[model samples]
Target: MAIMDLSSLNNLNLDAGSIFLLAITICAFLIPVVVILPPVGLQKGDALLQTHTKAGVEGARSNLKNQFSAEEHAPADGKPPRVHSLVVYPVKSCRGIELARSRVLPSGLQFDRLFMFAQLKSPFPVAVDSTDAEKSQHKWEFVTQRQFSRLANVTVDLWLPDEMKLRKQSMRSDEAFLILRFPWKEDGWRGLFATIAAKLGRGRAAEPEIEVLLPVDFPSAAEIKEKGYTFENVKIWKETINALNMENELPDELRRYLGVSNKLALFRVDPEQLREVYRCAPSEEEAGYQPVTGFQDAYPLHLMNLSSVQKFSSEVPKDDDLKELDVLRFRPNIILSGAPAYDEETWKQIRLKPGSSSLYNDVSFHVSCRTVRCKMPNVDQESGLRHPREPDKSLRAQRAVDEGAPLMGCLGMQLTPLFDPSLGEDRAAWIAVGMTIDVEERGNHVYIKQ
Candidate 1:
């Protein structure tokens, strides 16, 4: 790079104002290459973000025809697949709660993705030059592990007052609570000792774990209307939802734990509002029902086979000292076992065999599409640390099976429950561990661009 001659500006014989304008012009061209361009190349965050494109859609649909000529059915082997694990994330991107049994609802497993963390909107006006989209981004936006990997360490549990004997003495039986537990805010030498002790599984260090109790059923919609309770419009993907702000209930310790200096708040999805699934949704004639979701990234439910995860782990590069990759990293609502690896790729519908808690019909889930992967799985659930690269590299190398999202790797299947209209919304069914999973239907999945 040649150094510009400072003497040339004086030789131009221009006024001070003109000289300043000329300098600004020079900087406009040079600054992008020197400062902005290099950082954007270094960031690589946009590559991890999924974008829908016309070419991707065309490629996926064109390849779908060649993928499967006819529908495939489940094998009739003596040992059928069974539900191995059930997990639900009450808060988006936070640690999930594993259950032996959970009530299946129209939206999803009860309490799944009902709450989320978001960056609060600024009180000031938007920038004058900002576009509508940029202005919208200034409002409350959803936060996730992709931006804050430490969220993985935040453990969440749903507690009903009726279930606990001690709570009954202090509160009404109908009252419920969402128990949030996270690392205690510590710094300096004490923070080091606490982190080390926590890693070593010492009992003493566990006492510093901060617990916050949030009323799951507080500040009803009626209360919001009457008292003008605090609320904000939170943007999740392309949708903006009206959410009840619960930041007042959380302590300042949480903000420190999240490493957020700006305004951050906890929000509960409004029960009165219903957000329906858009991408790859079946027609009412085909599904006989409309599927809905809360704060979930996409569909109502997500399922991953243990065999598929095991296969994926084996293929991932083991260059790091990190532990083996498991299904937990993908955060599936249901984990199925006893099936061959990648067998779900062809599955179109799955039925939970009617057992002792059977309703009039078997509970079925329609396979929406293959879940496209991002860098989120790189975040370790237990340690809350994100690996620089490994699984994501492996995913791009081998798991880019979906032609629709050819650049993206895929692991699990997105599912929407087949709601029986006659059953009514109030009637719910229970899905327990060890329930037999029957592949009721199978076909090639078509990826509909979001």
Candidate 2:
């Protein structure tokens, strides 16, 4: 190591003022450098000062960077992966909207999974202190594409300014209102029209004419135990927590739309207060990862790999439509391209460097864990029909983690945005398409094979 020179200190007079000046100079030079270096054998007085004076700040800074920078791990892929596309499903299981760009919120993309459809009878008032799972107040079970493939046909669009103006009281913002598109009911005017047409000579009746459209708005209802905003205890999977469940014509509107007795509600993740992310790794828990999410299935973000999707498709018996499954079937917040097939499965963290777009600048995310997928992937996103086999079948043949829990056929991974240490959960840096990704950490490509 090249040593730094400290001859300038001796030029000062040997007076009281000179001595104090010498002391400050010594401290300023040694503080930054001493932390990284080892305890060395020090010669008496003058020799010790001379040795340390040669230990420069540059070496200390280099060591610090190496210890903390993204490149500390195996240097990221030479070509650096780029975001291929982005999708945000505002409502769970509903069709996802592809975006050229999107705001990266702590709970995932903005407006993603905020609203959901639930069984009508399944919703009932929950007692604040009830021990029975069903008795919990405002408890409702949500439905998804996993249960109904037609859910993919229920496309959602955001309302514009004029539309929001008409329903401002119910909708929080102009863009907040969702224009829900539903498939035509099997039994309705079209059914009668088709029945008559069959008698008139038009062969078999065409499927219900087309689709029905509805606008949904969430109006504030009575406040609950959570203090301020409308709070309800909603059960998802095995967990139930307090969330905002707005009341209005929406529940009835959705009921009529689906021809089912079900409740519909929007979840608002209050910035001041937040829902915690559970089951984090021990390291993340120690790092203070009590992150808040809105209506995401679990983690704030889901990342998919295009190569993995293609590789999986290659393994399945080819059909024209199935061949065209694309990335939408996976419903990921971010998609990465150019990485080797299934390579992302080994990543632990990624740093997203912005491309030409300024929207994605200096955003990094930590991989929470692998995404345990459901049968939702088996449903073709385009036709809103189940493929019966292939992706799910092939995945099961290769990637079942546990026969007891078949949902563990991992395809993608969940990501938690790593916020500035000072900001914590208060704010999240946004990311967008065309962003270049750098893998900052990697783990052994290990999986539980049942």
For each candidate in the order shown, give its overall lDDT on alpha carbons. 0.74, 0.61
- For candidate 1, the 10 contiguous residues with the lowest summed lDDT are 48-57
TM-scores for every predicted model: 0.74, 0.64
Off by over 4 Å in 2: 1-77, 120-139, 160-175, 185-230, 246-248, 251-274, 281-289, 319-321, 401-407, 424-426, 445-450
Residue-by-residue lDDT tens digits, candidate 2, 296-389: 7777888987777766666777686576555678888887766776788788888989875665568878776777766788888868878777
* Error at 351, model 2, angstroms: 0.2
lDDT of 1 by residue, 272-376 (tens): 775878678666566666677888888889998777877788788775555688567898988776788899999988898754335434688889899988899
Models, CA RMSD each: 20.4, 29.1
